[model samples]
Target chain A: MIEFKDVNFSVDNKIILENIDLTITTNEFVAIIGPNGAGKSTLIKILLNLIPNYTGQVFIEGKLNSEWLKTERIGYLPQKEEYDTKFPATVMDIALMGIAANKGVFARFNKQDKLKAMETLDKVGIKQFNNAQIGSLSGGEWQRLMLARALLTGSRYLILDEPEASIDKSGVNSFFDLLSELHKQGKTIITISHDLHMLNKYCTFLVCLNKTLHCHTETEMLTADHIKNTFGEALKLIEKDY
Target chain B: MLSYAFLIHALLGALLSGISLAILSPFVTLKKIAYMGEALSHIAFAGIALALLLSLNLSLVTMLFVLAVAGLIGFVSRFFQTEETNVITIFLSVAMALGIILISAKKDYSFDLASYLFGNVLLINKTDIYSLIVLSVVNISFITLLFKELFYMTYNMTVAEVFGIRVKTVYYLFLFLLAINIVVAVKIAGVILVTAQLVLPASIAFQYVRKLKPAIIISILVALVASLIGFYISWQFNLPTGAVIVLVEFMLYLLSLIINKRSKVRN
Candidate 1:
């Protein structure tokens, strides 16, 4: 469990996020949603204890963040993590990063590690592209690859930003399903995104943010007040049938 | 040919610089801040100028002064300034001006500016060798102690910060490591040509591999080979060692490009 109390962050003298309070309970899928430039990304960052210079106190498991060592407990996937895709690396090789987190750098991957990596990739439907150059994959394909990586880590807490942003409808659905399965398995997920439709099924909690934050339960329903407070405009349910 | 002692030292210097920087460059290139090399190189030049103006030993002043200036610039650029390039450019210009002023005021300038501009294996001495060993040790140790921080920062700075990795501390450490490498390299490829060590090896490795470790390994191999062969050619043809090393690096880059193109065609 992680908590941020009265957190504020500024970049280049421009106020990004201010007076923020967030808490992630056990096995909670908190989807932080806000319009573009609404400081959603900064909120996740603060929860992780990344920006200590910012004015606030962050406690991990009720201890000062400085006292807590970051374990392989939190798995992360960035919004646009680029790879040499042209660089000759296999899907298995990428997944091994999870293994590296557990085993020291010098430890060789054994049979079980390889099998787990393969199983994860297969679940994401890119098992056949195991040896394929990451660069050769399409946008949607790469997203799945990243998902497979996060899943393989078996991290208790998964932090993903906009996993469905570039993926096609089918890929988005499958990814959402994967998240659903992961949640059922008791993984805690913290994600930041603006795609309400894709997140509606899996997300149990929501933090509508725009420089400030308002936390609400999913079934509580997003009100007109919540929409204006978060997005400063109407919620556009633009459908891609996605 | 065997009696040429300084030539061996120069070649060894290049080899070490190439190999070490190659291993280190992946982290630098990943963050797209490879310009740390250029920034530190100018700062080294400023050290040389400071030595000249103070009438101190050229090598000692250049080494110590550059290290200080590099640290100063690194500290300022990472903490105070938002745009690194803009800060580096400002420091670089200041260093160039200092170098010019010091050179103009001095009456007896030892050695042609070319050897200092490029590299001169013919001039390497024991002091240079000693400095390279010490500086390389510092660079490698710093990297070893902070490999996790470096990897995390490279992949994602903001996330790394949240994970309790001191992003600013890592930034300063990297800048210092890069600065040390530049200072040690003055005896091999000179200040202006230091960019090749920082950029060339890593970029070439990037062409061949994807993983952070392999790219770094391949880069060191490529750089070491280029440095040794370049020195050999320079010795055999009685040519400038600096230019030869750079030429060899360029050729490797070109060869890698060709190889990549061919592989693309086949795929």
Candidate 2:
């Protein structure tokens, strides 16, 4: 389980996130929805312990975030633009990095690690590209590669930020299908996304956020008012889709 | 030339420094910080000037001074969230001006600045060889032990940090090692051409291979071969060693580009 108590984050005295109280239980497919500049990414950053100066307490599995981090790891897939695609690494080389944090400083990745990485790649349906250069991958294939890396961490909790931003519609569907499969296998997935229709389909819980926690409830219980409160002017467009 | 002790020392120095810098070249290129080698070498000039002015051990004072400035560069960029290139560029000019001012302040300081500007590999001594050996070992061990961490951080620092890899620590350590490498390499390549040695081999390797491990191996080979040929030509013709080596590397770079183009056309 993960819990955030009275979380608030600010930069240069301007509030980015304020009074964000939320909880994500085990095996919950949670989707955080908000407009652009609505502090959605900042919330994820806080949960990942990437933002250290936030005013609040974050607990992962009953331990403080810092303490939990020392003993545990979280699977994270950042925005695609955050990493260099032209890096001179093969697909296998990148997938193997998922286990780097767990190994000692001088330890090498053994055959078992290679086998596991390949298996994860296979699971994500990109095993054929195992030896391919990362720069050769398509946008959707790159997203799958990142998903494989995240899965290789073997963490029960996965956090993804804008995983579908660059992929085609079909790619997004398959990606969410994979996420749904992972959720079925007892992984707690917390994702920041813009696709409300997909969220309504797969997410078990929804957290509406726009610089603050507008609402937190089951996906089935989400209302038009909740969407309106979070994305005021954009509500009509979102409602059109619904 | 082979019988002369000084010539042999120069060869040994080239062998060690060539391999060491080649090992670090791919990271520098992949991170897009190729200018860092040039920046740090200029920073070392200030260190050299200060040491000359204070009548101190040149190598020790210069190493300390460069390391401190490198650390400061890392700190300022991280703390202020400024573009690293901006910080590096600012420090490069500041250090260059300071070096010239300090050298001018010492009216009787007859330390040959030309030797440092263009390098004199023929003047390499046993002490230089030993320092190069130490540098080679330190660089090799650091990369080997932390290869995974470095690879991950270079590819994606945010993801590396998210996964609990100490990206900040690795980044700072990388800067310090780069500073040390620049200071040591200054003797062979000089401040003017050091960045070429640090960047060219990797650029050549990248043109031929897409995989990093092969690229690194190719980079090492390119550096070693260039150093040997450059050393020989400079010894026979009495040309400056650093300039010759950089020229050989540049020629190799052009060759790689042509070969890569041909292969693409053939495909």
Candidate 3:
């Protein structure tokens, strides 16, 4: 579980997130939605302790986020990075990085670690490409490989930033399906995404943000009004019978 | 040629430098910090200049000076959210200007600054060889043990931090190692020509290899081969060792590019 209490983050005195307060409980799939420059990624960065200058309290599992990070594991997929295509790493090598915390800085990857990486790759449907160069992967395959990396450490919580950016439409369905499975297995998921409809469908809770907390409620409660308030524009929500 | 003790020293120095520089190359190139290497080398010049000015041990004083500057560079770039290349560029200019001013301030400047600028491999002594060997061993071991962390951090620092990698410590350690290697290497390759030693082999290795493990191995091998060939060429033609080695490395990189391109075409 994570909690943000009266968090205010600024850059050059321009407030990024103002008086923000929110809570994410265990096993909850929460999607944070907002327009560009809406502090969505900033919130995640604060939770990860990447931006430590924020003036507020952030707790994970009843302790400060930094303290929690020191003791606990949180699987993370960064926003789509612009990596060198010739970076000289196989898919398996990239996936193995997920378990780096468990292995520590000096310990070599054991046979068990390799087996786990392979298994995780299989879960993401990328086992066959395990030895292939990561740069050679298609965008969809790359996202899946990153997913495998995030899952390799057996983390209890998953934090993904723009998880769907690199994934194709078809792959997005399977990706969400995998996430849904993980949620059913009781892993808390926190993701930042722009696809409101998709997030509403899979995410149990929705947090609309726009330099402030516009709405923090169940997915069903995220009406068009909340979207208008958070994004500064209104759009019709598609009705679907599930 | 091998019978000459000075030539042997040069050879050993080149071999050791090749390995250490090559090993550090991937982290430099992959992190896109080639400019940092350039800046640090220029900063090494200032250290050398100050050492000359104060009549201190060249290697020791330069190592200490570079270590401090490198630490500052890493801290400023990380904590201040500034562009690292820009920080390095500023340091490069300031250090170069300061080095020149320091050198000029001393009226009785007996040291041949050109030797440190363009390298005099034949001047490498027993102590320099020993230092190179020790630094190479320590740096290679450090990188090997922390290879995964370095690779992950190079790819994504935020994700690496979130995974509890102690990125700051690792990052600072890396900068320190880089400083040590640059100081050790400045004797053989000189400040101006050293970045080639830290960049070319790794870039060449990446052109052919698909994994960091093999890439590093191949890079070391490439460096060794280039150093040997360059040393031989310099011996036969009486050329500058640093420039010849860098030229050889550049040729190797170009060759790798062609080879990789041709293979892609064949595929």
Candidate 4:
């Protein structure tokens, strides 16, 4: 569960998010949607406590976001950047980072951490690639690896930023299907995305955002008007048979 | 050679510097901060020149001076929100200019700039060895303790920050270790050629491996072999120790490149 109380974030005298207030309940799959520069990522960043300059408070399950982060209660997958393709890291090495907080800064990974990482990789369907170079993986495989890392934290709430942006169209359905499966297993998932169709089909709750909160309700309540209001234009929202 | 005290000290300094550089290299390469060595060494050169001019304890003065410069580099890069390479370039130019001015202004003590620029094993002493030991211990401890944190930072800074890892503090700590290593290495490789020790072995290891742990182990082995072979070659030919070691490492890197290419073609 999460709550944003009257949060206002600004930069250099320009308001990026203004008077934002929302609540996310437990075991709810939330998809935050907006256009470019619409403060979707900024909202996610605030939730992760990456930027602490906001005017209001963000509480995660009755605790402050900062405290939650300190306890490693939340897991995140940020938007992919142009990471070094030739970086000398194996799949296991990257996956082990999920347990870094639990192990602390000074301690080495114990047998349990390695086993959990391996199990999570198996859950993501890429356990066979555990020894493969991370740079050699396909986009879908890499995203799955990152998902494995997120799941490895043993956190109830998994927050992802644009997990589908880099994924191919054919891969998007399977990816959301995975998230749906995880949600059925009672994991609270909050994700930011530009893809409205996937958000409508897979996500239980939709929070339309645009520098300010526009709507937060069931996915069925997100109409074309909400889309126009949030994105400042009319865009096609594909209707899929559920 | 065994009877000479200076040779023994020089050998000890070389071994320690080689080990430290082997550890620092992979991080530097991964972080894309290789220019740090060049910038910090230039600043240390200025520190050395000032120490010679004032007839002070060269090691103490140089360490303090380079530490201050390292702090400034960290501060400027963080505070001004500028690219680290840009800040390093500015500091490099200023430090080199000041070193030249300081060395030229006081020409009485016969401060052989060439020996400092290249290196002279005979010049190493007990004080340099002591600094190397202390700095090496600190560096090893820092790397060992903060191994996971550093590895996470290298993989992705955002993930590290989100996990409450104190990315800034880790970065500053790394810069501190780097500054200390540069100071410890000066007695063995001199300012101009020292960064080769930090860069070449890691580069060679990266050419042959795709895993961080293996790459690190390979880097240390490469550095050890090069230092040992180069030490003997320099001793036999009466050549500069630092230059010979760097040359040997560079040649190994070239050989790795060829080996990698041939393997790729065969595959």
DockQ of each: 0.25, 0.68, 0.64, 0.58
For residues B65-136, what per-residue lDDT tens digits would candidate 1 score against the true structure? 777766666588778856757877888889878887887777787646666667666666777677667766
Which is superior by lDDT, 2 or 3? Answer: 2
- Give the Å shift of residue A119 in candidate 2: 1.4
Full candidate order by TM-score, most accurate first: 2, 4, 3, 1
lDDT of 2 by residue, B62-117 (tens): 99988888879879999999998999899999999999999999999887898877
lDDT of 1: 0.73
Please give the distance, in angstroms, between residue B169's alpha carbon in candidate 1 and its true position after superposition.
5.9
> What is the C-alpha lDDT profile of model 3 across B200-262, one tens digit per residue?
998999888766777888899999999999999999999999889999999999999999999
Instruction: Kindly list the per-residue Cα lDDT of model 3 for residues A1-242, writing each as its tens digit.
Output: 78999999998999899999999889999999888888999998888888978999999989998888787878888786667776677898889888888877688888999999999989889899988877799988888887888888688999889888866777787898999999999899999987776797899999988899999999987787888888775333322222
Spell out the clash pairs found in candidate 4: none
- How many clashing pairs in candidate 2? 0
lDDT of 4 at B217: 83
Task: Give the top-scoring candidate (lDDT).
Answer: 2
Model 4 agreement with the true structure over B98-211: per-residue lDDT tens digits: 988999988696867877777777787888788778877887788788888888777778777665665667887898788878876876788889889999988999998876
Off by over 4 Å in 1: A1-24, A51-60, A64-73, A82-131, A148-155, A210-215, A218-233, A237-241, B1-3, B6-31, B52-58, B127-174, B205-221
lDDT score, candidate 4, position B255: 97
lDDT of 2 at A135: 81
**What shift in Å separates residue B264 of candidate 1 from its native position after superposition?**
2.3
Better of 1 and 4 by DockQ: 4
Q: Model 3: how far is B19 from its true place, Å? A: 2.4
